[model samples]
Target: MSESDPHQSGRGRVTAPARPSGKGGGKGVGEMIAIYDTTLRDGSQSESVQFSVEDKLRIARRLDLLGVDYIEGGWPGANPKDEAFFARAKDLKLERSRLVAFGSTRRAKVKAEDDTVLNALLAAGTGVITIFGKSWPLHVTRALGIAPAENLELIFDSIRHLKARTDQVFFDAEHFFDGFKADPDYAVKALMAARDGGADGLILCDTNGGSLPGEIAAIMRQIALPDVRLGIHCHNDGGLAVANTLAAVECGATQVQGTINGLGERCGNADLTTVVANLLLKMGRHARLGVEGLPRLTGVSRFVDEMCNRSPQKNQPFVGASAFAHKAGVHVAAILKDPVTYEHIDPEQVGNERRILVSEQAGRSNLVHKFREMGILDVDPNDPRLQDLLNELKELEFRGYQFDAAEASFELRVRKALGQLPEYFLEQGFRVIDNRMVRDDGAWIMGAEATVKLVVGGQPVHFVGEGNGPVDALYTVLRRALEWHYPAINTVTLVDYKVRILPQALGGRSGTGSMVRVLIEWRDEERSWGTVGVSEHIIAASYAAIMDALIFKLYKDGATPAV
Candidate 1:
């Protein structure tokens, strides 16, 4: 089969099935549930989420590649950024998913054709348009300040007008669940209005996100729309967004609207990654993304998080780093024999891997498994060296060295013990001087200067450098001194630096005297790795971590001294 074949399955590849041809008419009309992604729209509502026009376009392309059925770009009429995104999106050439423009229904006091919002939706130049309208009577009576009948007319007119401009018009019945609880008849009336007005699908939205799975399923069954397709949009306020979405699917909803990693306002929207996994693995439903797209789920999740400049949640469901990690002795032993003994599914199915974590909680079995996995040792479980390594690891953890977050440092320690580590350079000593003064431009500046002395090939070398801070200055001098011997060090960059103060009870007296743990993440062109250090002085701890990072990079690159 060709790479573009929609049925292919593999790692880091998605095979988007053909789009469904028909609209929602009744239960079981279509076996596939449309994965409508709102990551660019609702996801931007997350705190600290700010996507530029380029970011949105990049995400849209990624979602399309992930085989989602629809990608909701943004509210084109809301801001110039969104307008520019739509303008750029027109040239995206998405293969399977339809690009959608989101907006609210026309204002109650205006004609649909004359509404600037609807006009912008048309101007977005997408084939699909989604508009949210008030479903709750309270929103109509208080928020809109319009009569119930007038609200229904607004829903009808808005969808009808958009249907003329586009073949696909999805009506979002905002607060549908809450609206049904407050006034069932009126909520049903709103849905019916959208259905009668030629909406391709009527999405029941839990805007407040307080509805339970049972309540959502019950309400979905009660909604008697046989001709219109039903879609579900839920939030994570109640921590049941995925549950409620699944419940709706079970009750015959055919479309699922959600954001990647559940990014949204307040709690979040439904996490489409979780939704897709559950549907394909548990519910036995067919998706356009298909089982082929499952392996790329974790990659897509991390990619979205990276674009948002957020760390991937290590404990988040199937895709998390710790999802399949075993730390206990008994668990590791059982999993090594048969992973199904503990794991629900194969981690590789989602492009994740089983990891045996070495910690104080780990035992002989855990150590053996971790050693084998790390390619460090494959000796007997009762080997004395294994026990020694475990003891040393525990002692390091007691000193605030977190191997879990800094595996590279842990590996180096193991190599040193095995007498396999090459001494890249001998550090004689280093000194840093900080000077605080006002600049000529009246700006306050803290200048940091550092002098580093190192021995390479039995020859002493001294280097001096300046930076904005002590750590920066130290790294600058070190890099300048080492580049002559290890040119590959230039390719390695410190991508992130984190520090934490160990609790007084752990081992410290007061604020400045407290022991600090530093974790530095380094990335080269090929890969990224983290190293950790712990010491009483913050600068000392940072220096240790920085040295470990450089040594790890050199070791990985096989850098040797010049002749």
Candidate 2:
């Protein structure tokens, strides 16, 4: 079948089937709930996550603007930075969000008034106070070296005393799950003590983060209470933080606490992104948290990742890089017809765009998707000529060219493969040499020699230049050569460069064909783009990638290539 046939027919070529009718769950839309972000306090517990005083205030304001219900700044009295944060936060006009100061209960023998820790909490000037007390008998008797009855007194005195200073008080039963397993009666009594002391909510903390979802549900069912709001704060040591939170909710918890992107100590905290997405779309309910701001979720996630200098997990449920990416021919075809077939939720809802990956596993649907993104629709799906193009893509991907990682280069290649790319300068030959010298002043001077011959608009240009490195020298020579021949050709810059070595599994063997991946970036007044080059030799790979990027930029600017 010729590729032009489908285009000529103007009928359905590929698309998804109609969604099943009458399958919608009733009234699962527009729910109002609070987003309590602890990225400052709890998130800092992540290995090596220490925010400066400025960082803490900046993050707190951002979270406030993002409309989170509460911001857990930090343990007020624990450190100087946290103390400074509390003092600074006092004057900020953070409307619609409350600042919750976190700390543990007072010592076993001290009056809450005289307790330095409780005093610090009051001085923080926060309306809400969250205090954790030892709930597990083992912790009370062994860790704190106090009798279980005395530990109960500590829980009561702390909450009751804090209640006098703050209108809202929450009791965190630390290690509530494990404590329940050890002594169910004592665990229930611990929560009861907090309630009796006028606490607003009983937060059952899975402090060790080792409990399973099924176990969480069973225990929650056992501790079902009718008096106050039941909350769940789960850690991710077992990699089930979200799962346990959901299980707790299903078993009857009113409030859920999690850090955005699951940023907490040990493995991490439950991810509110995943939990809210699942609850809204999968569970078919107005997620306890509203989904109206879903579009801002990705940007918010990125903002925090950047602040923490941590990369977002690529496969993170709704906000990950690969969340809406489609690859395999069948999958791409399905998605093209109907995105809902494979996608659980529309990416636009989460401020993420869908991507069609082109590789060995790709189909012509990938080509169509790419073309569409570039504003070229109505592609011929059954063109026989395009079959060879798909085959070429497969061959290149097999040779270690990954379009998924190097999208800029892939776009240029796609145009070239389709005979739509314009040529600028035809390089006849190029050579580069590198040299270094140690100066008498204890400094090293590195240099490069580059020679290039190129034809631009039927005129021949030869140029030689020196630079700090061989790649730079070659680039200087090429730019000089092009500029000498065609003054209209724009200058290019290498904003970023990356090199990767492909390792073979045969006894840690190294080969002459060690793969190198190079990414070159460029910018103009309007926009910027990154292109990739892959080859066995590092220099050659960089040159190949850089040339492709320059050529593509020229073509995009309506400059014709020199033959």
Candidate 3:
């Protein structure tokens, strides 16, 4: 190992020179890294990720719009859903991305044309096809029960067969990194076989995802094929997928494959969001996804989560809710002076915003900043009123009120404290009763009824309603009571409802007496807002949140009836 050689060190570690400022030609400042999104395919393999046929279509369109170079639609032969997705994709009007169909290489001793998986890939009607073959000799002998020499033949035969069918064929050398570590000659031979068989690109896969960055770069440098293009596919089992993928790129790999939000099997795959961000912002790569599409990165990440029915990870890098949120007083104060003081990148560059979170740790700067954003702009940063408001917020947070996700509720509280909130209605009282009866056939029937008394527009209004549950019954009666005065209530719809039992320490009690926090998401034709409430009684907490949601809607709409 010589100092002049960047590929090896005295300690047997692989090293690479600093990333070149210019390599693959593009408009950007750094080398171009092709963005290949497998969100619709590999992403759906996550434990909680299940994409409907429609979800696949929507995500494909989104990825195309985001300017990814390729969108892997999934293995068409694996399930009917994937087959249907491909069938439906024929009618899709994609602008930029090339749709690719994924499948394994030809089986042992089988002709590629005779393989059902290969036929399915052709039937998918995609111009591009990606077939993964076992690069590790161990997998060939153990998993496929084939001779190592025959495995190389399978790789060559599969790519040759597919090359005849399509002009663009990508060979995924599965477990390439691990296989290289075990037998470097076999791994290089497997890739060379694919290249010789007309593979346009050979993607080195960290299938087990245990390779370090140094190992990936060192091995990539050792590959002898200089003419064939290289790509990288990394899993996150070791939590180094992103680092390894970037290291491969730094070593001159032209393309990177990953899933949105890192959704995949086991620990998941490299997150395309993080990969693209690091490529463009950190490495200055001229990626297929340019600076223009970067702002929509956050929305794209959330859309995929919505389709998968998974909560967006707040701490996820680049696009998470807490990614740019400042909570500490010192941090908030510095961020107020200059966001770059605490944030690595401008949130708006990624279609996110810097958030000043107000908690017990909040300073006067936090209150002032949040107040201005909420349209309560008259408060001074050093005023006693701001201190009072901060004290109230801390006390409420002590009572399990999380204002981070319920900014509308927090605004209402501040307005009320400042005596700026209008009195829209007064609640007199509300009651709910539940009755259960068993029929002769041993079927149990449960019914709930709720009555609401309120003074709206100086008029006493009483209403009663029945529903499947107490909360529904209460909402029904409340809406009936307010419809005449506030027709806008008809436009408001409850989109989502969530409840969580606060921990005993936060709930200020134990057992059944502990407080339940309710978060309600409401949307009208214009926009959506979330409100939260906490109470020992679930119904009461739900009602409180419901009221807050309604009030927020009315306030936003400037609805001022003579109440």
Candidate 4:
């Protein structure tokens, strides 16, 4: 907050490096820089990271929609899935990002014409090709078992051959910084070889991810010249990929390469999602392409995390769970008066919503803010009921129930305990049974059947259904029970669900008074929302949360439609 520079070229003295021609040239001195992402290639290289062919296609389309300049798919010959992805991506009606296929340069003795990998890359049919060659002498002599002179020939000849097939060829100088440090002459030769070989751009890589930001900037400044466009590819082994990438941009790198959610081998690659957002909104870079719906950043981030089966980092800058989270009494009080006081950027700007964490440290101002978000603007902070709510939060906090991550359930609990929640539906009774079987073919199957009776609008409904889990079976019966009347009910989905057990101390009866907290997230085509429920019985808590989610969806969609 201390510094202010409205110009978009970049913040402070850091400027966008010169880029390869035809990939959108570097903007004016204060113009915003463009971003390129490689989540599909480098990101998926993380051990155990696998994207279904469809998953790869969907993400590539989304990134293109977000206006990224290029999407690096993968090393075609290294994996069957990647090869299939390259083939499938060829047909996408992409308007923004040009699909890029990645691979290493031709082998030591293989001619460009006979190199199997190079031929596979060309057959992938992408207009852009990025091939890496050993820039570090250690890698060339030790890893490749090839002499320095031959490695240079490999670099030059590989680029030369690929150039004839595609005009957009990039040479990724793998381990360029370390290579420059160890043998600056050979490193410079590597870049020079790629340049003469018709490479469209030369990308510097901190392959081992050990270089510091200042070292990266200084080295980049030393090697960058007018003839060759400069780019950067960083890894997060040192937890400084993003910082180093930004510094390289400042020193004169034109293109920035990173992955979504910092996902890659070991620690990860620079998170392109965070990089692009910070560059545009905080650093004042102009997006050359159309990303007017920047709010979708959060949604896309969550969607990718879901597909990867990784929990979203709570404090990941911008899109993490705690990016805009507010706690501490003073901070909450200040934020309630004006969010700008505590929040650096509006969460809504990136498709994220602000969250006021209700905890033991919260004050009446925090309660007022949370109440306002719940659309209860009339709640009096000075009222005794408000004090009671604060006490309840403290009590719950002591019992291991965090409302900050379960806001929906917390809101409903507050209203119900305060006698403010309406009785739109009530459960009469329910029963459940589960079964499992092993087939002769060595396959196993598990199933659950549930029966539930409920009353809505003074009308009783009975339903029964089977499912793969007890919770799922219960949800099915509940939906069937209400489907006839609440016809708009199918629009709801439980995006996220959680369960937590509250601890207690009672010598031998500790579990007697324990609490279970359940959170359910729902989404319609327009927006996403969450609700929670808490009770002693886990199933009861889950059902209560599910009911809250269902009812909330109906209320928002206006089953009546005229309201």
Evaluate residue 113 in candidate 2 and report its C-alpha lDDT on the 0 to 100 scale: 87
By the lDDT metric, which is better: model 1 or model 3?
1
C-alpha TM-score for every candidate:
0.90, 0.87, 0.91, 0.79
> Candidate 3 residues 502-530, lDDT tens each?
88987458888888999888889999888
List the lowest-lDDT window of 10 residues for candidate 4. Answer: 1-10
Error of 4 at 364 (Å): 2.1
Where is the poorest 10-residue window by lDDT in model 3? Answer: 5-14
All candidates' lDDT scores? 0.86, 0.76, 0.85, 0.78
Regions more than 4 Å wrong, model 2:
1-33, 284-289, 443-449, 466-468, 480-495, 503-513, 521-524, 560-563
Specify the highest-lDDT model's number: 1
Please give the clash total of every predicted structure, in order.
0, 8, 0, 14
True-structure lDDT of candidate 4: 0.78
Model 2 global lDDT (CA atoms, 0 to 1):
0.76
lDDT of 2 by residue, 102-147 (tens): 9998997788789999889888989998999987989999889988
Root-mean-square deviation of Cα positions for candidate 4 versus the true structure, in angstroms: 8.2
Against the true structure, what is every candidate's RMSD?
Answer: 8.6, 13.4, 5.1, 8.2
